[model samples]
Target: MSSKEVDVQQVLNTVGEPTRFRIIELLSSRPHAVGEVATALGALQPQITKHLQALEAAGVIRVHRLGRRRVARLDRETLARVAAYLGGLARADEDDAALDDYQRAIAREETRLAEGDSTRVLRFERDLPADARSVWEAWTNPARAAQWWAPRHFSVRVFDFEPRAGASIRIVLAEGDAEYESRGHVERVGAGRLVFSLAPVDPAGEPLFEARHDLVVTGEDRAHVRLDIEISAVREDAAPAVAGLRPGWEQLLDALDAFLRTTP
Candidate 1:
């Protein structure tokens, strides 16, 4: 029979049971009658017999008449097919490490969350299609920055974004009918590096948290960018923003990556 023809889910569901798993383990060594299995497990014959019937119906085991008694053994074909299916999942895929990092960050933040005034650090790295100069320009240039600074489905309004030290910065991102205003200033700017801080307020004009961002861009032809961000002064009302930090940054990076690919 073909691989697709195997009832892998049924077999898995049947063997997933604790008692049935032990029964399969017992049968793996050799064929066992219901009474013998019951004796080995210290279980009643009726319970063992019922389990055997389920295993057989699910193609996890095969039962046959042996000397006026039923004997059960592992159905090797069905199990081997399941093993093959599981083995296929071990193959590698692109961006898997990024996905794993995001998952780990989520777990770590969940464990570290507390009541008030919490702080969180986020690190993000990406290799882009554009050169370091172009990438830096995209950040420093107000028009270029406006094109890609916001996440998907959001519009950006930049009040001011001067790259020099102590330059005041203000930008607002809007989604649907709501807007989040980011008010801060550029702290330092040098060759392919920028340090800035943003204190974003929610739609209701309530202060959430202040995020300090340190960004570095390097390489030629292909740029490698790193962002180290510290989110601090978290308020009680900003828990939802903290929870969505990873996914939200992922979307913004996605927007940047897309913008770089299409730009000169």
Candidate 2:
């Protein structure tokens, strides 16, 4: 029904009466004649018929003359619309609660940063359908890393990537007209884990902030592996750069998951 034609108050009032509500409940099970409804609900035939009329007028039920008898049935489409409206209300409440939680987290983080907490740590873990060797390759391969290193909406370019310890790493991220670049060194490397650090830099190669990152890969099975990534701020001034680290890593990991699903 059109929004303008929806009389919510009228619908509520029509169903507010106990007798009418009972009749609607009865009709909900199946179509029934007035006499049948009266018999099922132990209601007087005249009273049940009047209740059905009110419900029909409110568009809650449909009545038709079936041969010599009148039959009534709940309007499935209207009931579905009402159900969807109630579901939307429930979803709205959930969204509001989640938003409140996010705001509180942001406030707490801001307070911590303002208090000069030089070390901020963020971690992410995910299981992907790739073996340890393949996962390792994806992480260490510059081209494969570029395919999923950035967030869902951003693009990434690898300037130089060397996974060996003490090797240099540089990456460029682009979104629209904006570009973000970071350079770092692989601190340590092993078969299952790697440690590194990155400093956001300007176009002239000036360091903006510093972060230490640790990545661990564990084989879950012959065909799957679990990856853990942790990033920590190395300086008090790095707080601002690391503030958005959690979600940024999450988005990157999510993109990686998507890539693995489609890669092979």
Candidate 3:
């Protein structure tokens, strides 16, 4: 086998072990000395050092001398090259089956988890010269909504939208080839408040996940909107979804503020 092939196999074999996987996970966060990693893993320092040396040989990790201690960290560049190679292989018919199987196994594991309710609420108050009707029109209007929906790194496309009760809205966000859809029926529409349920839709327009949004115009010349977003599947997973949503909601509120400021 070629040297590159040998290195690839070596990396796969080393990381296939549970202990080595843990070591990589730790090193990915920050560089660690052999002794520190050993202590963290409750293993002998010698065993940790051996694994580190093997990882280094496989080009999966890099070691730097830190005075008396040697610090090790993940070699991200090397890993990126490995990932690119894997993606190329995945495009091949023979390798696609293995990738499909791995994905199916992950999906099965995710499905087995008990469902829970994970809801995040964000409220914002903003002043605008536009009346409630105008504001509502700006929000539900495709052209106006796209102008400020995602201020950074996202573009919105609305195919269908109506602001009245029992009407549905569909919006697609584009970032590269990655597309996300939000669709739902308008549940309530008051003098200044509009409540709706939004669920992500697949490419075929099937609901992927559901969330609720409540926009209340708490004061005239100003409006207060609160979005109550709940994802059943992600609620069960908890950690990642919770961590991601906290900042995400804050950013969305910021986007709304920008939108209100720009809208007449």
lDDT of 1 by residue, 87-114 (tens): 8887676457656766675555555555
Give the per-residue lDDT of model 2 (tens digit) for 1-264: 764565767887888899888887888778998899999989788888788888998889999997989999998777677767767767756446544755666666667767766554565677877777777778888778878889755787555888789999888888888888899899988877878887777668866556777788887553343334444443444444555566667677778778877896
The better-scoring model by lDDT among 1 and 3 is 1
Better of 1 and 2 by lDDT: 1
**Candidate that scores best on lDDT:** 1
For every candidate structure, what is the RMSD over all alpha carbons to the true structure, in angstroms?
7.1, 9.7, 14.1
Q: Model 1 — which ten-residue stretch has the worst lDDT?
A: 108-117
Of candidates 3 and 2, the better by TM-score = 2
- What ordering of candidates by lDDT runs from best to worst? 1, 2, 3
Q: What is the lDDT of residue 11 in candidate 3?
A: 78
* Model 3 regions lying over 4 Å from their true place: 1-134, 230-246
**How does candidate 3 score on lDDT?**
0.67
Which pairs of residues collide in model 1?
none
Model 3 misses residue 36 by how many Å?
39
Q: Candidate 2: lDDT over CA atoms?
A: 0.74
